[model samples]
Target: MSVTRVELAGRSYEVRVGSGLLEDVAVQCGPLLRKQAVPIITDANVAAYWQEAVTGSLTAAGFEPHFLVLDPGEATKSWQVLEQVVDWLLDQEVERGDHILALGGGVIGDLTGFAAAILKRGCGFIQLPTTLLAQVDSSVGGKTAINTRAGKNLVGAFHQPSLVLADLDALATLPSREMGAGYAEVIKYGILGDHAFFAWCEENGAKVVAGDAAAQEYAVDQSVAAKARIVAQDERETTGTRALLNLGHTFGHALEAETGFSDRLLHGEAVALGMVLAARFSARKGYISQDDAARICAAIGNALLTTEIASLDLSCRGADLVAHMLHDKKMDAGTLPFILLRGIGEAFVDKHVDLAEVGAFLDEELAR
Candidate 1:
């Protein structure tokens, strides 16, 4: 068991990650929920896997439990889903002070957090992250969002969770592919800043992917601690620190968008490939050695991601992909700053990057 605290201006909370935390949820979250009308919002997939134990805990504690279950996927992270969740909250009579439980992966957390943020102008919420991705990244940060026709996470808020319940037991139900996707984000913490942790991932990521308890706890604890520290200093992403977290995402999101945000490309896989390309591109820019880039790709392969992106012969060109990045939510003043790296453990935001150069590089990768 490992616990890390994320402190912000008015809202600060602890991210408790470990096995059997779900059973202790009521005890741990009692003060956080404040005994109000708390609603548990999940998707159909997670509901099938975790609905019983979660509702059982709430029911045992003598609190009324209402559920809002969405169809799971990036497609569900839309304005339509937002409307449906808001209606469910209205039916439950959820208030500004009440808590909404986001009980799935990133998609569920983002939609539910946005709902809580806008419900009567900001309701409280708790995070019950069931997937590794949610447990480490989405569940802790105040960054909540819904995707749009323009791009992913185009509409959202910065409403933080009152309590984040990261139960490793919930991960037992994850599909192996889904686990790999989430692991991509787990590796991201190391790539962005922490060299020692990056080395640890190279060594123990296999243990985590195999669902080892201690490795799972450490991955969640360290990842959350890294993100919490960044969020604390720059909650709204005022500085470029939070943007570094998007390391591989800009290119990955474009791949997702081109595929119409379907199962053909999961978020984590996109990040996995995107990070590979980012490293490759950095090597092309002479910032990092090709050997360093190869090591990054080797680490990604050890996690079992299909990094034969070179062999994919993707239907889209680098120029086409660059166009998709234009829709990125983080773009500013007509220039899209990229999160590039000089080496494995060092990531930086480069604002003046020329898109044509990025397009040429993508074109080369796609051809390979």
Candidate 2:
């Protein structure tokens, strides 16, 4: 097991990455779980695959496991489901001292963490992220949120998890498409901060998605470590240091909205294409070379992810897409900050971005 610590002052937590961690979940989380009844929130898709292992672990440890299995999808992260989860947690008689387990992918982790955050003003929650995207990005950041009509993750809080167990065994059950989706976030870490890691990903991404155990562990561990270092520096995203983590999210969220946030574009797939757009946009702005931008796109394409907005077949124009971005959570003082690349692994926040120019750029991309 590789343990990466998110070193937040007075509230630091460890993210443990390894195989068979789920089977040993009770032992892994035994210290934080204070009561007999262990509450786990998961989506139906995940429950079908992982519920037994988690249940067995907790039960064997003399703890009664209670699962609130929800319908899986992006739509699950909503006010309605949030209300259901909060009400369920209340019925579980959970306390601030006790830790609630978020046992599934990013959706489960985000919803459960948000529920724990607002429960009795504040409570503890552990992240058992079953998906690669969650393990590498969402699960570690403490950025708990639910999508609102206004925009994605517009209504959310920075509620850190007590611990995170990223069990590799869960990846074994993931479909190839889901695995590719997860790889987008995995590569995002490399693209945003570490050039060497980006090169490594370029070489090993296929193996990682193909369920190569060593490659998956390295990718997860490296990605978690990269995120942990940043989170420790700016736990609340106050400094621009942490904003680099949004390297592809701004563009990705807009694509998500354009697609109705459905299966048509998975969050990771949106992000994959978003990074491509960001890179190309960066090149257009003279921040990065065209060759470098092409390299970035090539790496994304190598992972079998969508690398072009034109391929999405949206009826909207560039201006329409930018209209969706106006609702982005990162909007400030009527300006949206973009994470543009200076080069591979060199991302910085550009707050003075012109939305009109962005619309024009999208127009070109849409036409292409």
Candidate 3:
């Protein structure tokens, strides 16, 4: 087991990553097991694979496990579900001193965390992320939110988890397509700031995707560590440092909105394609060379992710994509700051972006 510490302004938490972590979750979280019965929120899909082990572990520890399982999908991250979770937690009589366990993928984590954030003015929560995307990215940085009609993650809070348990064994049940989407976020760490890690991914990304234990642990550790360092410095995103973490989020979120936030485009898939678009757009702006742009796409392709926007078959035009982007949470002073790359492993937030120019770029991309 490998543990990484995420230090924030007034508090810190450990992100525990390894195999069999779920089976021993009770022991790992024993100190925080304040009540005899622990309340957890999960999606049905994850419960099918992991609920038994998790419940068994807690049972062995003399802790009763209560579960509120929702239907599995991005659609669950809505205001409707958020209310249901909060109401259920209240019915369970969850107190602020109690920590709720979020035991599923990104959707579960985001909804549960957001619920905890607003429940009784804020409560503690633990993240038991099952998907690679959640384990590496969403589960860590304390950023939690539910999607709104406006855009993705527009309504949320920066509520850090009391603890994060990323059980690598959970990946064994993930379909290949899901694993590929998760790899997009793993590669983001490299593309944004760590060139060496990106190179390492080029050589070993396939191994991680294939369920190689060592590779999985290393990638999770590295990705979580990178996010920890950044979150520690800018917990509230007061500085531009934390925004760099949204390397491909701007374009990805637009794609998500265009697709109705459905399974048509998984979040990680959108991010993978978004990174490619960010790189290509950077090249268009003369920030990076064509070769570097090609390199980014090549790496994404190698990870078995879609690199072309044309493949999604969206009926929307570039103007439509830009329209969705106008709802992005990153907009500042009516200007959307885009994270662009100067080269491989070098990403910076550019606030000088012109929406009309971005729309023109998207128009050209759609043509190809």
Model 2, 169: alpha-carbon shift in Å? 0.6
Quote the lDDT for 195 in model 2: 96
TM-score for all models, in order of appearance: 0.97, 0.99, 0.99
RMSD of each: 1.3, 0.7, 0.8
- For candidate 2, what is the TM-score? 0.99
- Please, what are the lDDT tens digits per residue for candidate 1 over residues 327-353? 999889888889999887899998888
User: What count of clashes does model 3 give?
Assistant: 0
Off by over 4 Å in 3: none
lDDT score, candidate 1: 0.86
Model 3 residue 245 lDDT score: 88
Question: In model 1, where do residues sit more than 4 Å from their true spots?
Answer: 34-37, 310-313
| Model 3, span 140-243: residue lDDT tens | 98899999989899999989999999999999999998999999999999999999999999899988888888899899999999988988888888898999
Q: What lDDT is reached at residue 110 by model 2? A: 90
